[model samples]
Target: MSEVPEAEVVFVVADLAGYTALTEAHGSKQAASVVTRYVELAQEALEPGTRLVERAGDELLIVADDAARALRVAARLRDAVEREPLFPTVRVGIHAGRALEQDGRYFGTPLNVAARVAAHARGGQILCTEEVRRLAGEPDDVEYRPVGPVRFKNVTDPIVIVEVVAGRRAGEPTAVDPVCRMLVRPETAPARLPFAGRTYHFCSFECARAFAERPEAYAEA
Candidate 1:
């Protein structure tokens, strides 16, 4: 057995919401594809100081020395998942405190609390403890709304939880593909087509071809 190393760090756990239902609806193979994509997207979204502790099915445990960066990474993960048409929304929970690391895994009150907080979050929501907010400070791009003290199983006392609000800023232009419903930027879209007297953008050529094949199938009613 290895000794547990203690350190003050920020922990984040992100899990796919309604994963079981998605799997039931789409079968295991499709669900696995979504999970694989989510893991890849998360790895790309994390900041330099963050390390992926481990992955448990549809959930990922990540740690970082910078609390603010952890929060930003959570936001980015959520946004990335939202932009994927095949994946469900992700719920993220963050906490900053002293934790114990053993065998490349984290254990301690902070880690447990973060996992519990993640369970409380709804689809596409990011919840964090008050300590995380204090350490991270206020973010200009996102608003923090207090959800009040929440009680978790196996934890004494109520923990103050806050929701991180991140949305498209004003005047930010966005386009959604009708075939897959994924957000696409007009300038960088893989494929663009004119249909029904309007221009449509797609993330992939396959989606553009599908739309072109049956415009009536994807065209808005």
Candidate 2:
């Protein structure tokens, strides 16, 4: 067996939220297509900044130049997939401290931290370490909510976390779904029906119809 090489590499861990539900609901073929599409979309958004080297199950391992670019790409990945039906929401976990490279694979505390971040994301969010935030350029209206210190599954230090706000396009105003707490586009979700003036976005027609069926019920809730 070859020895692990210590080269201080930065690793990225990310995944799709509700992926299992999607797969079970759509079946294997459809699930594969959507998962593949999601991977492609994320790759497209993170290209030129990070290179995807390994894809396993619903998780991805990407190596980047440094912590800064990794965090940037994480935000981009979440933004790229949040609106698409392929993946409801993408969550990212990034820890950019150090890693050992062996046989073209990266391993270390950073990688573990990133994996934990990805694991902890609620929905359509990015969880990253303070080290990553240190390298992250600047706050551009993206809320970096502090998640406090967390003791990860592996490694020593209790990593600090900050939630990365999803990126928005130019000339676009962010819309939040009052019902389910998801961000949606005005043009994309115009079909959504609601009360006098306010509009709500549901993950699917089922959610919309459910809301429509009991307007007062959801409105009050």
TM-score of each: 0.75, 0.73
The clash count of every prediction, one per candidate, is 0, 0
Q: Can you write out model 2's per-residue Cα lDDT over 1-221, one digit (the tens) per residue?
A: 76755765566788866666556544678667866887887688675657888888778888887766776777777767765642456678877765777667776766777888889887677887778777765656555778989887655777788887646744333554434434467667644776756766654565467578767755633
lDDT of each: 0.83, 0.69
**C-alpha lDDT of residue 196 in model 2:** 55
Candidate RMSDs in Å, in order, are: 7.1, 4.8
Tell me the lDDT of model 1 at 29: 91
Model 1 weakest 10-residue run by lDDT: 167-176
Number of the top-ranking candidate, with lDDT as the measure? 1
For candidate 2, the 10 contiguous residues with the lowest summed lDDT are: 171-180
lDDT of 1 at 69: 88
Give the per-residue lDDT of model 1 (tens digit) for 87-183. Answer: 4668999998898777687878999999999999987789999999998898778789999999988899999999988655332326766665544
lDDT at 190, model 1:
86
Best by TM-score: 1
Which residue pairs collide, candidate 1? none
